[model samples]
Target: MTTTVLQNIRPWGAESVDLSIEDGLVTGLAPHRPGSAVPGGTEVLDGGGLLALPGLINSHAHVDKSWWGKPWVSYGGEATTQGRIAHERTERSALGIPSTDSTELVMKEFLRHGTTATRTHVDVDLGVGLDGIASVRAAAERLGGALEVEIVAFPQDGVMRRPGVLELLDRAAQEGATSIGGLDPAGIDRDPVAQLDGLVQIAVDRGVELDIHLHDGNDLGIFQIELLIERTVQAELQGRVNVSHGFALGDVQGARQEELVAALGEAGISWTSVAPPGRGRLPWASMREHGVRLGLGTDGIRDLWSPYGDGDMLRIALGFARVHGLRHDAELAAAVQLTTTDSAPFVHRDQHELAPGSRADVVLLEAENVQDALLRTPRRELVLAGGRVVVEGGELTL
Candidate 1:
């Protein structure tokens, strides 16, 4: 087994430690002090005064709709709601999603974020009309070694409204789609609750996870969301279920919102949020307090649906910290969790910290402490995946 030595690793501000790699696993980590013995064939990384933590994981993303990858959904900005939506409609109509630019750029930029794993959504062919799901799966395959990737066969448009959508969702799951996704409870169909229930049933039968997308925050959405949670619980698919873009919860008012929060808390459903700096709706604190697995995601990257995300989970993590007002320790955890803990299954090993026998998927930051690392910077001193150096100082070598 090829062994490498990382001599001066200040793991999450541990002061000092020596990391040993054996066959792509962190075999051992001993405290670093004077006269420390270096294992044979081990190349120690000079990472003193810097924090090293687990590689970030992007829990939810549209692989084919990211900027570095694809189009903005055109949901304009805080400046003008109607204008943003209009712009997005125009751009998305002109170029559409599941485009080549969206897929490739999203993948490339995700890697640039020190994300070794990602669970991304692929457009159901119903939306793009050319087996877009297959295309995304292919893209995920192409991005395999570069990033730990999984594709969810997502019914971007209403599954029932689109032709052959259910079959495609089923086929994708049967063939290896990690999760099933959908959008808008109220807008998709008259019985939005029933519609999503059907989709979740399909996922349950196929033996995959659920990731539902929601847009409506009004009574229709709240009712459907509650029903969605109830249906999952009834079917015994609670913790395994995920809800993306629960923006309605963040935007709703009064006692109704509180009631929804309590119910969602009971359901054990996780959530993924895309809170930009000025968006009126942000749900991190409530979700976290509710014991929900709050995950951060790049909903879109300069694409047709939304034009944001720079592909750096570091930035995403920092944004999460600032927007959510996380404490130092909480921020540290968020720094890793935004890309790690929140995103599951992609995590072949459920670890957000570097420890013995962990996969050698780690990044060295040019920081003096974990607090500094949490502060967010583009400086990635070194990135090691599977015990191989793929990037150093933000430069990709292999």
Candidate 2:
């Protein structure tokens, strides 16, 4: 049990203060003053006026399928969602990039960029089984305790379309997966009721969370979410469910959009967006007002699906603001919220804010304030996970 004092830092770039860490927990925080007692020569880190923030949380990611540190392979064939899914499955086996290698490389990059916690969706199907989960889990363990990874056993292919997928999802849950995922129920499975019902049943029986990917836009997408809400109510899993990429909200207008967003809030369902280009996601204020939490993620990182992402959640926040036209300081501040507190729940942790008694996972950035940090995607000066400095001077220490 070691105690270190971080002196001369601005929390959220506010008043200068000293943060005390002990045994991987934030023990004390107080305004910096002269003649601070240091018994037995305590280690004190100089913040140098750096802005301290809660560690970034990636609410949604595909760690298993990332192609980072691999040869660039362009996605071939049709550009449709289903087409890309098929191509991804075919090329994944042919390319033979070991999941451990890819996941480790991506996790390292994420750590380098100041993300200390994440929720990664590992692909689970008949062909891959639980291999993806195992690989990512291994990478997380090897990274030591600095990074916390919450695994979702994702059925990328439709539950009904792929025989034995539901069984595999259950097996993944039994094998320690924290959550079960579903693909486009209406678009992929063509049976919204069956897909939603099956996922809910598994989630209820296994006592795990649910993360459903709904890419179907327009009326079809809205229909799928409605079915999901119905099932969620029936199972009484409102707060335990997340609807990722509910793009249909972008298609509807006025009263209809209001109606759907209100329903989502009423059910207490969470939403995550990768900030895809040309897609309409939930309005940040409306969702927050309705009590529906929102989080951000880098869906795929230079994967077979697309060539993108460098594992920087700050960079993702910049792009998200740009895509959504979040220009004002307040707006950008709101966008930053998506990457931190709002996303924390997906990782099975309470909302992480820079405060005394909070988890000691935090980042010190070379910026004046959070809005500036988001806009600049400033280099990380220091990163502490569990009160231990794992990254310093924009590099990983362990």
Candidate 3:
């Protein structure tokens, strides 16, 4: 086995430590013992003071609806004709119905930006069942270990507002969908709690995860979230439930928001992305201050929903950096946990880390210190999964 040694690596502590890779995993630590020998087929790699955090997890993505270097529509103004366009795009991608030449380009861009794992929601409303689901599935499969994807059967139109939304979601799950999706419970005048419960049941019955998109920014939204927490706790579905785009939480001020975080923490259910930066306001700080188990996600690749995302985990982490005034070292730590273990619960994986006997999913970055690594987009010199080098700088070898 050619042991690859990342001469110096920065870990969570914001300190530089030398690490060695054997069979695609950390084998020896220079910090543990200085001047460790090359295990076998060893190639020396210099940290160059870049941060080597864990790969990033795109908590939210619509891979079937790839950017493909296309122009994305702007914010809320998208619910109309643009949504229809996006919906159709999903159907074409899922059926493998010969997308524009740009489709392949989309997936390539995703990898270039360092998003190793992405959970994408596919539209499957009405006659279009699991629209774009197959496209993302195929693409994710092709990427194999380089990039892993989790698909959710999302009813882009509405649950109650659309026909067979629940049944279609169920079908998508049965047809290899990794999880199910939910939209604004109150947005469409549906019983927010009922919709939540129904979706939760579908996830439970299907033995899958639930990734919901929340749009209620008022008491209605908070009520729905509270009900979700209540149901998750009752079902003991810890780490298996998540609410994406709960920007409404940011709008709700005072004790209620504090209560929401507390309840969510106890239930082990988390919300993604406080709110887009400079969009009037955000609740990320308060949510963190309240000790909520929050993680960052690029809610959408390019839609009326969100127009800015390159699937870069570093960028997402950096977004948190600028919006919340996070220091560099802290950003490094955020990137580490955000991708690897912190998201294990939502993704249904066992704990992972550099510690003994973890799954050996490690990334080697070139940075002298943790702060430098995060402050700068350190090169992912090596990305190893299951003790095999999957990606290294310019070379990608699965």
In terms of lDDT, which candidate is stronger, 1 or 2? 2
Model 1 score (lDDT): 0.68
- Candidate 1 displacement at residue 63 in angstroms: 1.9
Q: How does model 2 fare in lDDT?
A: 0.85
Better of 2 and 3 by lDDT: 2
Q: List the pairs of residues colliding in candidate 2.
A: none
C-alpha TM-scores of all predictions: 0.85, 0.97, 0.80
Question: How big is the positional error of residue 209 in model 1, measured in Å on the Cα after superposition?
Answer: 1.0
- TM-score, candidate number 3: 0.80
Worst 10 residues of 3 by lDDT: 95-104
Local error of candidate 1 at residue 357 (angstroms):
3.7
Task: Give the C-alpha miss distance for residue 35 in model 1, angstroms.
Answer: 5.5
lDDT of 1 by residue, 1-398 (tens): 68888777778667778778888778788887756767566676666545787777787677775445322234554433334434543455456545564676567666655777777777765445435665565665665476667777776656666668778888888888778887775666456766777787887799888888776665666676787888878988877677776766766766777667767778888777665665425555666687777777766666655555677777777776776677767556655566764565444356645777677778888776666776756477777776777677687765
Off by over 4 Å in 3: 1-5, 12-28, 32-36, 39-50, 69-107, 279-291, 303-307, 327-341, 364-368, 378-398
Runs of candidate 1 with Cα error greater than 4 angstroms are 67-102, 127-130, 252-259, 278-286, 327-336, 345-349
How many clashing residue pairs appear in each of the predictions shown?
24, 0, 6
